[model samples]
Target: MYFSTSTLLLAALAPAAIIASPVDADLTPEGVPKITSISFSGNGCADPGSAKTSATVLDGTLSTSFSTFKGDSSSNCQIHLQASGAGAGWQVALKEATYHADVTLKPSTSLSFFTTSFWSQDASVTATLKSRIDCAGSDIKDSVTVKQSTATPVWSQCTGDAGYPGILNVNFRPAVTGNEGAYNVKSASIKFEWRKC
Candidate 1:
């Protein structure tokens, strides 16, 4: 009887132990958003003479600017970020992007004696996803065009790669007339979401 009781107890405990086994450590973290890297590319946005250069785009500092001016030509400036990956070795989903900039025209170059300066400039920005860690869906992309002289924020949505880390590219452009006026971009950033299993 003693031997039979001991055997039954051991069997009961064995199943419990197996059921309580530890889960894989790799899949522990879920839905964590992280920024991997950031880069800048442009026709002349980084040039020494341009107002806003690649400095702000590369630096981790958000809501800041390397140069106060950002607009010289349409589609001449581009800022790219390799984000959407968490520290747990998994990729997150890119949701949206926010651009921080003060779209005010460069200080008037018109003579002080001039009663009125028709010099005006506007900024038009766009966003797109170049590549993804996994080619599982349509590309994520969006755009926003605003005309303002004060510091205002704009946003773009990620419509692609709903399950993997991807590249986010943003373009900075300025429209000007009547004079050599330019616009400014202080900073740009991306938002990430937890990827689904």
Candidate 2:
């Protein structure tokens, strides 16, 4: 079977579940960007005892956050974004990918943005294929670590040659195998250049 690159990428992402729909009712044609949905393998709170679900990250409010339970030791999640009328699965020229994190959160968590659709870093198996899926930009080349205090969210702005379908996948996982701690995430947003498709 000759599956196109887009086909393969979408197939890979199909199973992971869509963590957040980047645009929804909260987002009017002119309103603060809002996350629409969120999908996860297992969601809980960083404190282990705190009862918080992944929904906290998509509420469009920084007051709350999403965190993995303390005992899990490892965590992975994905967030998807597209313009209001980008048309399902349409490619979008990304400008920025932003997310908030607590300063105390260790560097163990890394973030990666994909143009097409993908589940994990492993999905970018070959260098050739990896480049295709990777959104090329000075701030986007490597796995982005959570920096800037919770008060200051991490924002990776796209410098050049950012091209991908309306579907942008923000994937995150702890850097270490046993990185047991609060993988706290406040919110995620993607800025795309809107154009008639």
Candidate 3:
């Protein structure tokens, strides 16, 4: 078969054109929300000096060292995160969260950790993990991860206003008043996922 130089050049460029085509808007890097600011509140972080927050494009984290988080008491903390880049016709949601802690529990004591997350103008979801000790002098260092179901994802509001930020609340509650226990929350992080509005 006879092929012209122009024809061969067009064929050679066809594959490149296909490769350079636009990808799915949902898969774009811009869909990933960036955490612009973070703030901490509540009794768990009462000493603001003991809490720290850091953020990235896809996730945000809060770490705290508690001095008074001890026996028969409950501590609570609220994390406020301002997410940007998703305000442009995009919405974000909490895909998953991980909580890590170091706990020492006396016999017949139980500890529970709860996390609730929500965005402005959105409903919240809570996840909980519990630990119990039957033996004395029990020291536990562990982490729990909670994943949101894709079928019922709680998405952020489609608003361009920066005033609306995501909120995450954590509560640590201990049971059995007679026993002594200590809890130190090492860190907690939430991974965000986004989609077109």
TM-score of each: 0.36, 0.32, 0.59
By lDDT, highest first, what's the ranking? 3, 1, 2
Per-model root-mean-square deviation over C-alphas: 25.0, 15.7, 17.3
Clashing pairs in 1: 31-194, 52-69, 140-160
- Model 3 gets an lDDT of 0.46
**For candidate 1, what is the TM-score?**
0.36
What are the Cα lDDT values of the candidates? Answer: 0.31, 0.29, 0.46
Q: Which stretches of candidate 3 lie over 4 Å from their true place?
A: 1-32, 59-72, 122-153, 159-178
The candidate maximizing TM-score is: 3
lDDT of 2: 0.29
What is candidate 3's lDDT per residue for 95-119, written digit by digit as tens?
4444455555566555554445665
Q: lDDT of model 1 at residue 181?
A: 35
Clashing pairs in 3: none
Worst 10 residues of 3 by lDDT: 7-16
Better of 2 and 3 by TM-score: 3
Task: Please provide, for model 1 over 1-197, each residue's C-alpha lDDT reduced to its tens digit, 9 standing for 90 to 100.
Answer: 01212111111111111313232323323333344555555653566544333332211232214353355333345555554423334322223334433332233321000000010111243223221011123321112222111111222232234322345454544444333334344444343333223
After superposition, the stretches of candidate 1 with alpha carbons farther than 4 Å from their true spots are 1-31, 47-64, 68-75, 84-164, 177-180, 189-197
How many backbone clashes can be found in candidate 1?
3
Instruction: Quote the RMSD, in angstroms, for model 3.
Output: 17.3
